[model samples]
Target: MQMPLLIAADWLLVVCAEQLAYWLRRDGLPIAVPTFHIPDVYLYLIVPAIFLVFLHESRMKFRAFPLWKMTQAVFHAVLWSVLAIIMLMYFGHVAQVVSRLFVAMTGVFAFLFLIAGRTALAALLDRYHLFEVPVLLVGGGDEADALLSTLAAHGGCGMHCIGLVTDARVPQKAAARCAVLGHLADLERVIGETGIQNVLVTASGADSDEQVRLVRRIQPLVENVVLVPDLAGLPVANSEIEGILEGRHIFLRFRNNLARRKNLVFKRLFDIVLCLLGAPLVLPVCLAIALAIKHDDGGPVFFAHRRVGQGGKEFPCYKFRTMVTDGDRILADYLAAHPEARKDWENDFKLKDDPRVTKIGAFLRKTSLDELPQVWNVLKGDMSLVGPRPIIRAEIPKYGEHFADFCLVPPGITGMWQVNGRSDTTYEGRVRMDSWYVRNWSVWIDLACLVRTFAVVLRREGAY
Candidate 1:
């Protein structure tokens, strides 16, 4: 049940599965099974190496294994197996000798074996609580209560609360559930006695100076000293400390396409090519929109808004004008008069039946012809054919720190969010889709989004 033993057992299972796969591929079965020429030793190295790389990339340590993490490891193992088989066929110089069907069967067997082993390990770990870590909560009042609640929710994942340590006198209700050993001064003594390996302090109960002192004192005793920020709802960008004192300032950065540079470049190239090819088709639709807008209200045919683009740069994004002239002014007055519409506008940034939209504009928006002008932006390199949707300055505040990180790449005319659900999705859902795109971007992914966008546009799904 110890961490080292658990890790050793997992490693052994992986090794055994690899060996079995090798044996199956090398030898013919007793019951008249087909045999193929296979490089058994090569896969032995390939499978483990791929698993190790995935493990490192995921940042999962042996002590804190979770079922979800284990499932991901198995999934990556399968992916790597497929990749290795492809490489062998293409470049291993022995494709003529090996049966392609046999190679495929080996991959499937290996994948199933990996998944089964991990799943079994996960069940065993959960049943026994083999990797659970003893944690000592240190705080008081509502902050302490909130910490307790969070620990209770995620208690299965190696975080066991021993008790609480508070600066102020513990409330009777909290004391009933968790023993309050002592105040801040008793932290070190309590941790030592309880054999606690982790100390978690809430920012609300512990001030900056006290937090610093607690960290320094607990550093030598416990495995880690964790500070839970006061702001529970806000997303925290992953942060790191660099260099020694004087240079040791914290750097906060969002998790993005750090491992996807090559894919991003390929995607950008694909975007350029698609935009160029679609220009002729998109131009005529844009012209028609321009003519329609001109005929309807005799106003500017295009709406140019200063939008946050790549790296938070302000760029004029073009769209066919979908609203009446002075629509911005009209919006404020209309929202004031119709409180229900204002509430909906606050939630979705859209109004279903607004007087501001011209008749032609309604038709254009329904079919998404209004977005044709953004193809020019894509051609001009201000945007991509696929990426996060650009937002105006007014919308920046709503996105908070994530806004800046989202702007690292150019905005897109059609994106993962747009194809997935568009205006029907919640703000949080949109953020998740955008983040997913940033992390998993590829040329193929872009193409897939474009293909799906065609279907979405045709169905007019999620269009207001």
Candidate 2:
């Protein structure tokens, strides 16, 4: 039922995209752009059918994918669908007659409309567990509890743990969260009784041989069998599993995407292009911020805090001055006077309501306009547009072993920490997020972070 509804919703959005593209080409928008050739609307109605086929081929209905996976699948489907349409048009000798602008606009609108629609649909389905796949956990303890917590946090993943089937004594924490239906011996009976569609086998104190046998026995009972390996907190984003010796042995390959020379060049080019394109809009806001800061304090417009950059190099990170000249003294004095505030500062190095912040600075920090001057750092090659957050020398000990990973990429104006929670995130959690970003660095991830940054700033979330 869920699959059919999702497919219908997707088909409808594709049709709507075609109409919107036609409307854009036919009618002029407020922004000026070249438009030519009146597109034949009826001739393009077959686009939705073609797109739906490509989407189905992408396996969107196979499993409940996380939001990121769903986005990637939809993007690929739309891209391939557009290419197929172009090829078909060229072969049919209709490419010259149809408006090229209309064709391009349709692809753009299709992706936007599909993403918006799918996100709304996923949220709606999650509210009622309409599309969730019920699965039985074959292990119970810390492993099962951790998996349960992750599934609960990401409801869009479409997995729901129905019960546990471990032979060992269930830990109090796991027992409290999930029902232990039966032991490993009753795995078959449990599946029959509960009508479970999938089985998740976790490595919870089970020997390799026992685990393998359990998987083999359960494979015949469940429609899907998912193996949960102990590979958490590792960079598996750009990894692949290869089977050697006629599938007798298998090993996972992890690629260091950031280390590639071509990727580094591309990342730099990406930063420069974005900075150049955004200068016109950013310049005006920067001017306004500079004026407001001057009016509020009659001090310097910019502040450069010393921070550790790529390769553990120190540089002055530029920002609109959000604090007074005597901010260091004010912070020290305030922390000494207030133990609670001191504890908070020692924990995250941030204060929700610091007395040192000027009136204009508070708004600037909330809106993230204070960091506009960091564009200079970006252009100066001191920073990338998206990477790990710049850390101070005092915080180096917090990162510990992960500090090396953090130094691989230049610090960012905004990165996983800024987009995820910023000041609200724990110091340790920020370090973890930064380490993850460096390990899993990709052009797509950077672009996604940049897009999420705008939404985070606009909503004024997790900022001082």
Candidate 3:
């Protein structure tokens, strides 16, 4: 594993050194011409050696070559290489000797070179399974079978399942070629015999106490131990390590903290600027929508509903009324009459060809113009320009405990899940997307989502 990375690093160093020398000559720096004198020959030798040391010290085995981890390593390598080059130049009493442009160019060249070469290296690592880790599955239930199938499908995780260990009766029937090593109680003995380096506890059949015991017992024997949470129908946004305590216990927390005060400030400023600038243009459309609504049905043009917002606060969310006066009552009556509509309602909270929607309301809902009134929500600080969609107060309990994480950030007019597939996506998928957005929030991501929202709204792919 280190051989390819070392060779790649050496080649990258040589190329960068040569380029730096050439660029220095071009810049009229009084550096020796390219002949037999390589300005940084020592770099070619020492850089790769130091890289190997760091790689070994960090334990960056090829088995854990996820793109994210690889990127982090590359970044670390580039940073160290830059610092090393600077130190070498300073020690050689050549601080003012080398062109700054040459040093900067070398850093950029090394970064790109390593990134490209790492891709090839990763391919080679995957081909040989050189760093595959032996993983032991500790359950024999349906979740274990599903996890096995998933692992089989994703061959790149580099986890080679040795076998399964479970006392559950049903697991034996579904256990594919994976042999049942022993009962759950005999996990320690199995680990001792097989030398399993990783243990994955399926959260389904195993009780919490059993899972905790398995972790405690196996921690001494194995290098990695992970517990799969039994969160069926719950969204697993994205996992992240919070910290390590006392060099023993690891803590993991999940929440989207990207929509912080800085982001909130920027988003609000953007909204206020855009809203003020376009108010004249938007006013006419608002009036046109009001006229259309009034013409279709002589009822109020604006609709207000209690929606759960940041920190689980209920606020009156505004939207263009896209239904008749007694739309909710009518919906209940309709669902009672036609049981099939209940399925659609349950899935998407929407009804196709909803009878309660007035003639203009149907058009507004299709184009999503009914949500225009939420601009006021953005103005009032009750919502953001980009965030998770707000849900009704009545829908809060259904989200369970993870709902608090989702509500940490204010709801948005348009968000990742909304632009991706609003009503068309599964409820669980929406929650997951929302959770992911919260976990991985960034201004650029918010801007991208906003741009995509415009395109999606124009296309109206899943508006209704």
Query: What lDDT does the true structure give each of the candidates?
Result: 0.69, 0.83, 0.71
Cα RMSD to the true fold for all candidates = 10.5, 2.7, 9.9
Q: Which residue pairs clash in candidate 1? A: none
Tens digits of per-residue lDDT for model 1 on 180-285? 8888788878988898888787657566787777677878998888877685433232233345567545444544443467756776777778778877887787
Instruction: Quantify how close model 1 is to the true structure by its C-alpha RMSD in Å.
Output: 10.5
lDDT of 2 by residue, 360-445 (tens): 88998999998889999999999999989898988898889999998898999999999888888888889989988888887778
| Distance from true location, Cα of 183 in model 2, Å | 2.4
Model 3, global lDDT: 0.71
Instruction: Give the number of the best model, judged by TM-score.
Output: 2
Order the numbered candidates by lDDT, best leading: 2, 3, 1
Clashes of each: 0, 0, 2
Answer with 2 or 3, whichever has the higher lDDT: 2
Error of 2 at 170 (Å): 4.3
Worst 10 residues of 1 by lDDT: 232-241
Error of 2 at 121 (Å): 2.5
Between the candidate structures 1 and 3, which one is better when assessed by TM-score? 3
